[model samples]
Target: MSKGPVLLTGSAGFIGFHTARRLLARGETVIGVDNLNSYYDPALKQARLERLQAEPGYIHHTLDLADRPGMTAVFAGHAPRRIVHLGAQAGVRYSLEHPESYVDSNVVGFLTVLEGARAVQAEHLVFASTSSAFGANGALPFSVRQGVAHPMTVYAATKIANEAMAHSYSHLFGFPSTGLRFFTVYGPWGRPDMALFKFTRAILEGRPIDVYGHGEMERDFTYVDDIVDGVIAALDRPAAADPDWDAAMPDPSTSGVAPWRILNLGAGRREQLMRYIAVLEEALGMKAELNLMPVQDGDVARTEADVTETRAALGYAPSTSIEVGVKRFVDWYRDFYGV
Candidate 1:
């Protein structure tokens, strides 16, 4: 018997595109869905889609997660046994300017995905969360056990909502679901809004790059390939209800009443913003003009991921160093942009 196709949302996205490519390489059929919204550059999304189209095992759908009917139709038509839900309105700063976008895409759109998963009885639903959910905690190496009720931005709040919504669905329907909280994911084919991409563009253009948090910010920058590996591992290993989970002191990462779990997928090595920029400069063979600036609102000074549980659960280990990842990204950027 043949394996059922995997329904991967955000197929044209940075992570989604790579995940789909990996699955196709492993001989798994992938049904890709994306709105290809103008959040950044639809042209870039189109370019990613064009690459996926070259694969024989890939099928594409131009649909938004907020479209309930469209999402339901996809579930009915595809009958996908597994799902990788990575589509969301993803910028922390952008959430402050346009909170409704986060609601439509992250909150409502997530509900649509859950409904589709429930309808299809998917073997496992692995969805993307963010390290920003650890807002205002001030905890070193943020762990899933820490309280996440204090989200600082609308984006984080929406992702927290996704966790809660998935938990409810998993408990009520007995379907397995895993949430991967990604740190600062960076590498080739990255989003233009991310710091790495923005800084690279500015440095190459000989423009001043804004050094936020007075250049004191730190991030566990996981490469896109490492993230995809963790994501696939989580998808292949369906979550199971914790038999020893106690109600009196419930663990936030796993549930006793549901087949639900959350894990941090990060490189586990915090790199300073200044050092990260230095590596990028080395890659480009140019120095950056830095504009030192205070921390932006709704921004944390540091984010470090505690991936102990992720490692134990999926044997996840991020192997890419920032220096190597930055060089790879610089090479891709130069080739893609003819710079």
Candidate 2:
């Protein structure tokens, strides 16, 4: 009568770490895997790993996803019943500077994770994708049902590729897979490279923070807790083939024949960049010195998530308001860094 252990990749990362923490707290076993590479700072990653290690139900596996032999061995050894693939070369701007990193981790590494699912016969495989996949769309709220083809950056392109790869795996191998197109996920123990963290850090230290798009950008800033809830819900119920799916007029969100689906996990409403900064300022009690600049390379002007399908399928509704979310995150930052 054992509820199967969930295999969580990128367990050292921000979102992955949060997901693992929540699962462990719920008395669920998580087989956490990560190479612990120096993407931002290995110290931060190591700290995350330490937190997971302290949890009773968490087991650690230090291995790169692209190391097929090592990854395969871990999967075969654990025989994980469920797979949550969150590891990838993140950061849209970073992708331009280091295209190879994106290829190695996002593309090659993703394929290895899929192979592990295939080998272990995981019941449900959920992978993390980005809202950036809807690049150059200029749509109000990015929808899962819409076709995403024009990705501006390599990172987005890779995610789009992942969706295609997962579909093939679902169709040919009969694996039930789900891809979460995450919006701007921010919270405590978050990525140092992310905007919220960067802005808070700079503002606290009295340094000028770069405000991209001349402070004209907006984002559907989904809290980490909300994103984690969506992830677990998606796993609890495996995606099924859309019974009414029409092959002639294919629905891009769900598969016609394969048990595959894509969901937008975000705070349905979008917020302006200035508004987010104001929230952070209030939480920190410090004003930021803005270094207004034109849109940086590989950066988007805005991002809005359409969570209608996600809400319908998994009863997903993100509850954390910006005020509460920002306050909590800043509180954690104060404690984390003793600020």
Candidate 3:
């Protein structure tokens, strides 16, 4: 028998848009969902949706994940057995300004998703987490094995809640779930709120760009294509209870009681913020008027992900360099915006 359609939330966002395209290319039926909120430019989201609409095996619904009845009806109607729950109000700084938004979308919306998965007894569910969950940790490379008890922002906190909620459902419902903690993902069709897009736009417009942490920050900066690869790989391989999981020495990445796990999806290399800006300048052939300042509230100075488990489990290999990724983004931005 054929597989049911993959219920993919946030299908209009950056990572979601890319993941949808990849899935469609592989001849998989995709049920795309997105609220297309005005958190950022809705035009970008619409533009992405237009592209997906042109492809075969793609179905889209304009709905919010927090709508419990709406999501339940979708599950009952389509009965998707594999779900990629990527929809969430994403942004650390925005979460500070609108903490309630995070609770509604990331927390409440996630509950609806969990309920839907339980209703369908989903074979596997993969959801997006973030590296910011490691806030206040001074570790060089963030690992899923490490304890993430110090999330500095409401956004990260909600993601941690999602992980816990997914684990409980997996344990209770006898389904599998996986959470991917994505590092600073970038590339073409990226969010305007992200550093890369903001810097690129400002440089082209001859506007000053904020240099947080006095340009001393670092980021793993995984490309969007690499992120899609990791997401699909994790989606294909359902999680299973780790036999070696001991109560006395529990591994945070896996659970003995549930078929649930978390993995870090990143490039496994740290690039300084200054170096990143310099690359942007080179790509756009324009120097940015830097407005140096201290790190903003709910901001971390650096982030790197240890992808050892991701590699061993999924054969994940991130081959994009900062230089190449930035160049690709610049090319796409210019073509898309006619800049």
Candidate 4:
């Protein structure tokens, strides 16, 4: 069966770029959209867009999710079959500084996307959530079934709102929706604010790298390619209302009233912060000057995702080791920055 054109928001962002590229490679048409905001380096975002612009099956739109008229126009014009809504105000710490951006982008903007998806009757609307949504839970491995009412950061709070908003839209509009809670995703063309990117840059520049949580934190850092694969899989397979989903004993991950589901996309392996830095050092052949610090407010000590349901649903298996992934990221950094 021919997969119709995909309307992919955040096509200039890391995972979005990779997903669009993969879809294009598979001969699927993609209508890419991004506001090109200066959340990070806009130049980096532009460079990612440049790559996608080169592809034949791609059409680019410079627009924001909060711009209802703009977003609605795109949907009206393209009428995409599937929508991958990855655009949002990302960054946990930054949310501490600017909380309104999260509200505008993640909350209001997500509502706009949901409305558009409903209007167009999209086959599936797959959107990005975060592992940080597992805030204040003392659990070792976070699962979708766990209650995520206690969000540590405004960014996570916004994502939780997104999940609820999507569910409501699914129930009312009958469009399938899936929310992916991504772990620490890192790889080539990654976000500059992320730990791996910042660490790599500071180490290469002979500067001190901030080791939060006093080097005791751990993350289930999934590779970008693995995440992109899971996202595409979820997009292809629309969510279905679970027959076993009882209202008396509701599953947080599945829906009884609507075709809405949540899944964790992680490598299923937690690596320590110190060990991750070591792998980066090995890749760059340079040891970092670490400035150990207390765990920031809104920071979790550890995060590990239970991907059993993800594996069963999508046949997801993350194949990249930290060593290999870090090496690949370093290679890309050096080549891109001319270092």
**What's the TM-score of every candidate structure?**
0.99, 0.98, 0.99, 0.99
lDDT of 2: 0.91
C-alpha RMSD by candidate, in order: 0.9, 1.1, 0.9, 0.8
Backbone clash pairs for candidate 1 read: none
List ranges where model 3 is wrong by over 4 Å.
none
Q: Rate the local accuracy (lDDT) of all candidates.
A: 0.95, 0.91, 0.95, 0.94
Of 1 and 2, which scores higher on lDDT? 1
Error of 4 at 201 (Å): 0.8
Candidate 4 residue-wise lDDT at 288: 93
Query: Per-residue lDDT of 1-339 in model 4, one digit per residue for the tens?
Result: 237789999999999999999999989999999999999999999999999999989999999899999998999999996999999999999999999999999998998899889898878999999999999998878999999999999999999999999999999989999999999999999999999999999998999999999999999999999999999999888999998999998999999999999999999989999999999999999989999999999999999999999999999998999999999999999999999
Candidate 3 local lDDT, 1-339, one digit each (tens): 238899999999999999999999999999999999999999999999999999989999999999999999899999999999899999989987799999999999999999999999899999999999888988888989999899999999999999999999999998999999999999999999999999999989989999999999999999999999999999999999999999899999999999999999999999999999999999998899999999999999999999999999899999999999999999999999999
Q: Candidate 1: minimum summed lDDT over ten consecutive residues — where? A: 1-10
